[model samples]
Target: MTDKSETAQPSGLPYAMSAYLIWGFVPVYFKLLSHVSPVAVVAQRVLWSIPLLLVIMAFRKQLGEYAAIFRHKAHLRNLLASATLVAINWLIYIWAVSTDHILAASLGYYLNPLVNVLLGRLFLGERLRPLQMVAVAVAAIGVAILIGDALDTLWVSISLALSFGLYGLIRKITPVGSVPGLATETTLLAPLALGAVLYFAQVGGGGFGDDVTTSGLLILAGAVTAIPLLMFATAARRMSYTSLGFVQYTAPSIAFLLGVFVYGEPLSTTKLACFILIWASIAIFCADAIKSYRASKA
Candidate 1:
């Protein structure tokens, strides 16, 4: 059974902030590994994280949690789906950052929450507020304008939004906690990651460990992936979903800044207009959510 603790709520603020901060700066991290293959980076991140995650799980004595997850067939299915979506999201993101397509990456993440809103309306039978309705519509307009110039990048944005939105939905329904859930997901995918590492190594492409810098970054990737997840889970347990929605924007906002200034990616007027509209949309949506949360709390 999942333990519910009132005490768990208080310690979550730092973790939540840390998670968002780390996530916001991820463009910088991947930029370091730009020369490394994105697929290989992701594969190693998944593969190398297994042992570290396991050690953490053992230390936490959450093996019972891990065991219980596998015992529930429905939860197993959810984890698998979540894993697939997250892996795809990660791969696409790494590629986008490494290839100087950070602008497209920013669009994808910016659109992800809106995608979740649509999914909630369609699948969860949630009703949208008036502001939310306008927000999404405006965001759609923004997307259309951006797509006019670079239609080819639309798939990247769409895929990132869809996969991540779906992953969030599935994760919300999962019974397992963060550490164990991530451990199990990574564990399930570990063998494939290991095989790929070995195959690429044999072919002289060399695995992450072949180079000191690459290996170090790969290990860091595991820590990076696991830590935010743990923090997000902690925050989720304490905070309202609406607050989470608001905090989620911090990541992409930082990514946008990094893309514009650090990566030296050109931002055309059309793309700028899209981002402005999207930001306005997010502001509207968050205002509505805040009002709703206050009303419910009161």
Candidate 2:
């Protein structure tokens, strides 16, 4: 039997688009929870996601398979690391949005694919194409441009990029289905999440029960967080990696617009220059991906 994910199917287009769009607009949802502590928000996300994902696994009758993956101690170990990385990514992203560093967050994501490319070369022994090398260097300069003007929040961008990039690397090497892997990660983090709830409540910062709207939104964080991830995994199954890569920019682009235009975050000339450089890098990188994909097909 062959892996379905290795083949391209037109139907995957909708799933890919839907996933990226939701991810793009997700800042809006997190922004709504601005009053909540980032820790509390992430805790709610992890706890709520457990139940929903378990239900999804059960509905798909993957419960047994999910359980079997854990029997491998190696898988368990890698998943623990992946879980930690994802949790870190979630916290930084929320903090960035609430503190008006959405542009930094946006830039982090804009640089993510490039980060992945570099990681692939570094860890997976993949060779970087000429354009890809240029893309990476260009993105680095874009990041370098921010060291002076945006030094204060530059950590947010780099942390987000590195953490998520590493998380993807771990997941790519770990042989498991996306949903199962995610369910396991949440399970591992459940204890930490519960501690966050208890600690926050003790300090009177847990915002879940503060009001009806807040509580409801916290509960729904599961949906907002898990759905797009699941959709993306599904889409990845039916699309070529290169094709999927082409659409990966949608989320950051949307978030960038929301940061500047919708939420009125100021964009400085220096930051604008960085974005332009990153965009140019993406163009070059994407052109390379297109050519490589076509060559493989030929």
Candidate 3:
């Protein structure tokens, strides 16, 4: 089972921050490819990520470990599931960004930590505190308001939360190192990625090799996808899941600000209200986490 403590490891903090910061700004990267189809962008992400991940594995000398995951059926199964969830999450996120639904995408990530909390309670046998309970309730109310008023975009937020929350949970339990696990996941995904690339080429539908700028950006997708994921996996292994979840706030916070100001996505009054309530809930959740950590220390 994953650790129940809310105390983040000092070592994990850097990795968590690095991962979330990149994620927060990733919408910008995807937005640059807005002319590309979401499926093609994700396919490029998978195909390009493979070699970068492999090189990292070679440098880390974790190639043996990466291969070992496939030999271990149980671990392989878990990684396959995780790969699927993360792929879904990536596809949805890119689609949302390309479609100018970044505000909704930001909201989804804002709710992700809470989803992690609930997943921890249900699957990892973590107990919730009074404040944590209140936090959950408030977040739910905020979502309810979103559902009532902005039903169209609610799916984007909710899907991102559930898929990513599940992916993190699986990675935490998979008993594989960060670089190896992600390498393995990308490897598992490569065949379909290859197929997608071929299909896009045949259909003349993809952005790759279209120009110096577009092709270069598409190639960089590998690094963009792998680096933060490796960092996140490292952080997840070092810290408590809930603490890691809280650290996730940084990404969405940045993304939310970008959505409103940089991206200029419209924020309806209802969405603004939901953001306020969700922020309040996050404050409550952080307080509860601090209290629990202190109590544990005592």
Of candidates 3 and 2, the better by TM-score: 3
Cα lDDT tens digits, model 3, 5-107, are 2134447889999999999999989989999988888899998898888887788677787877778999999999999999999999999999999989999
Among all candidates shown, the one with the greatest lDDT: 3
**Alpha-carbon local distance difference test for all models:** 0.80, 0.84, 0.89
Those runs of model 3 whose alpha carbons end farther than 4 Å from true positions after fitting are 1-10
State the local distance difference test value for candidate 3.
0.89
Kindly report which residue pairs in candidate 3 clash with one another: none
Clashes of 3: 0
RMSD of each: 2.1, 2.5, 3.1
What does candidate 2's lDDT look like per residue over 1-298, in tens digits? Answer: 1123424454677887898899889899889889899999999999999999999888867777679777989989998998999899999999999888899999988888787777778887778889889988999998999998999988998898889778867766776776887888898999999999999989976798899999999999999878886676566556544455567799899999999999999999999999999999999988998899799999
Full candidate order by lDDT, most accurate first: 3, 2, 1
94-131 per-residue lDDT for model 1 (tens digits)? 99888998888888878887887787788767788898
State how far residue 171 of model 1 sits from its true place (Å).
Answer: 1.1
